[model samples]
Target: MSVHFEERSGVVPCKTPWGSWYQTMEEVSIEVNVPPGTSAKEVKCELGSRRVELVVRGQQVFKGKLFGTTVEDEATWTLEDKCLIRIVLMKANREAGNCWGSLLDGQYSADPWVQDQMQRKLTLERFQRENPGFDFSGAEISGNFAGGGPDFSNLQR
Candidate 1:
């Protein structure tokens, strides 16, 4: 199960048997693709604080523990185009900016590229926290970032 990482959206595509997933600092979105023309009534999705279960067409597609805890009450699932199931789960610890290594425990861990991006995000967040006067929201730190990035040391906030 190879996963394709999209740099712009930060989405890890199709690492699981069911589908793809992406995450923000606050929540995770899972996209499960079913056969075209499948009805919503035929899909059953169950979300818990540390687990998730999906059943399609009366057969269990996936059932496993999650990599991180989520707010069960805030989780939601919706059927799109009659074939795609979108699940959104709010993290229990959103303020921490914790990155999930994978959607399911012991399975589909993020690739090196994704992990690098996650670490970069975390570092940018820490820089923002340390220097509240500067906005790091759109900053991109790369190989030559130090040489090409803006000089903030002398900037007046």
Candidate 2:
């Protein structure tokens, strides 16, 4: 099957032959869709600081080095409804406003649209950081802000 990715929540999910994944500032969530009635024992996941491997039904679905470091000890996975595998990985470097361009290193990178959204998110985070007293949580960014966006460095409350 061809790899397919969809944009959601201002980020593009990286779809793979095994499943799909998206990331937050502190975590990465992966969803592996397996056949119906598949048992939990059929799924085996190995997560490390910089690598991950998933095996299903005795078949290695995915094995690759992760794009960033993760706290493997804090990672968690669950088999839901006997067919869906949900995995959450905690990033070791939970730096504020940081974003990952992809799940796996040197592969399955985010598209341009997703990259733009990530840039916007980082900009908003900078705004929030600079203006601690103001809440930029509900701020909305629109239009093509690439290259030469507004400079709020001089703005004072």
Give the whole-model CA lDDT for all candidates, comma-separated: 0.73, 0.73
Candidate 2's TM-score reads 0.72
lDDT of 1 by residue, 56-149 (tens): 9999987899999999999999999998999999989764247777888877677877756665665565466557767676677775222222
Off by over 4 Å in 1: 1-14, 122-138, 142-157
Residue 72 in candidate 1, Cα distance off native in Å: 0.6
